[model samples]
Target: MIGPQPVAVASAPLARRNPVAKLAAALLFSVVLIATLDPVAPAIAIAVELAVLPLFGVRYRVLARRAWPLLVSAVGIVVTLVLFAAERSGRVLVEAGPVAVTSGVLLTALGLVLRMIAVALPGVIVFATTDATDLADALIQNARAPARFAIGALAAFRLVPLLGQEWQAISMARRARGVDAGRNPVAKLRLFVSTAFALLVGAIRRGTRLAVAMDARGFDAGVPRTTARRQRFTAADALLVAGAVALGGAALTASILLGTFRPLIG
Candidate 1:
């Protein structure tokens, strides 16, 4: 789920540039996109990020695999807002118990879903392109983030693929054990939850063993470590930083000039 295969990024001629540079550029651009609530800012960010996705050899098909979850989340948010928080409905569409679906509430919630996709799409692009190990290094070394926190985040990310595999294996094993088929949706959910809890227990045990093994191997606590692959900042780094800053400045100026700089939270 994270970090590029070192072999993959390393082999690409474009990957020779510093990892921290890419991370900085992505983070700065993302921050600018997030800073302004205006949909235009995120739309611009999505365009820029999508343009850069090819440079990293990202597959949209593979990216869609991750994007669906985000899309589902956006949909869930809209439904929840419509059900519970749509207190002011200019036009009522449905009435169930205390819940009323109104035209205005539906429109506002739909706008939020659109906003979520605009915001999330660019982040998905950046994450797909970024190498997790490089990200850890960029945060821990270049950005001077707390090494423990960075390392912990990096470590957690390592389990993405393993979890997926384990899920498949668990499903097969359950079937082999003569688990009933064609269960109701609730029953299927329960079965999955039970299997997932078992997987979590096994994963925790594995993590504990790994921690002990690393400690036994004389892994130092709170020590600054040297990188096997050092990322040296280059001219590209300067240009990217300047570009992100310019975009952020322009977005701010637009908001102020139009007198429509609404905070994203509201």
Candidate 2:
């Protein structure tokens, strides 16, 4: 099942490559972007991140649909920070007891919100194009990471969508069975909590079944994997990682030159 609707970008050959490489690149680039709070670095990172939506066959509209909340929350964070951050020595914009806004504080708040957006935007980009199963295989096989953990993670990933559908189905079934799950405010809240608990129980049962199945197959932590599909880092993989590095480097350079690297405190 599709998580969200796939975007309309011309599907690139990038997804065929090893997912570990792309994941590594994403993690590395995000770490680099987050290591500093300089607005210049994150701003540049944001631009690069914008390019990802299209490149990953993700439509702009799809991104907007999903990312609008993050954008809103980022704005909310800035507003809250600006209001609540302790008054500082800089030229005051507004002054209230214990809560002060200054030009410097406003700049800092803007930088903070921008940085949060920049840091979070990339995972949405990469995961949009990336296949979860493929990524897990790459982690286990190509990276020689622990197979058990990778497999468990992959199981959880698959379960997310399945469980959601199951929850919806269960809710409909419950309603059809005269559960009195009317749309009244109190009833809706009760339905939500009850449905959530039911879903949890169902999930636990499914997890038990999955564990039994895995055990029957000798899917132990130390077991050597049997080859099914081969996973390797291709040339595209190198390009992805290299491109992330270049983008990160550019961000760092801009931050230093623009003197936007403001650390939180010594």
Candidate 3:
């Protein structure tokens, strides 16, 4: 007999942890990595983050789906840096009009690529599993963020997935109605822009309605609002933050010991 299909739970232990912890971890590591232009520190951070992701229930396929765009961007960045990086002290490998590729430039490009990868991957892994509601709750409860700002931000974040879903439905409905935007590149582009504009207009209308509803419900009425589900940090949340700190510290210490640390602006 076929049993019921299992529903995927988006809330893993990592997801259960307070959203503020995740944000702080990502922000702190980004700051540390961004302080140095050296490749070694960021590379270490990326490797450590990848190693720890599975413990947080981030699967290979999930990571790949979210990472593909970043990978493409990283490649573009590498090409741009190689062509335009001003560091020319090392041996010139290739020369073109107004653009010279030197060993120094290539090295700097490598560092930049690694740094971006390090900074981007953790944020994707963290935010992909986090719920907008949980984030707003955490921000308001733990970070002392204004309730109005947190609630408004949460509403905006929640709309993104709905926007994608609505786009797909609109596209399908258009196709079924014989409003065919053929596969020609320009035609497809026009269709995309039209659909995007429609989506934007719809989103604005919905947002205005939501704001009115909230106003009616006395949201941000200059009084404290009570949440049905209070945000609370658990031991797991502490561990996650500690792990992030340790990872960044270890990377920086190793880079310093290896004499590969180079400040970004100093």
What is the C-alpha local distance difference test score of each model? 0.66, 0.75, 0.81
**Alpha-carbon deviation at 220 in model 2, angstroms:** 1.8
Q: Residue-pair clashes per candidate, as listed? A: 1, 1, 0
Q: After superposition, how far is residue 31 of candidate 1 from its true place, in Å?
A: 3.3
Between the candidate structures 2 and 3, which one is better when assessed by TM-score? 3
Question: Which tens-of-lDDT digit does each residue in 1-266 have in candidate 3?
Answer: 12111121455566557889988888877778888888999999988888867656777787888789888988998898876666577998888888888888888888888999898887887776676677888999989999999988877776667887889998999999987767788888999999999999999999999888878888859999877778887787777788788889889889999999898787
Candidate 2, lDDT over the whole model: 0.75
Error of 3 at 189 (Å): 7.5
lDDT of 1 by residue, 1-266 (tens): 45334322344434444566655655666565555555555545555555655555666676677689877887898789887783665987888888888877776665566556655665565566557787787776677777666666677677667877888999899889987446588888889789889899988987787667656754536566666656556787667667756765675566557764546666
**For candidate 1, what is the lDDT?**
0.66
- Across 17-82, the per-residue lDDT of candidate 2 in tens digits comes to 467877777888887876776577888888878866555666777777767878889788778877
**Candidate 2 backbone clash number:** 1
TM-score of each: 0.76, 0.78, 0.79
Worst 10 residues of 1 by lDDT: 4-13
Ranking by TM-score: 3, 2, 1
* All candidates in order of lDDT, best leading: 3, 2, 1
TM-score of 3: 0.79
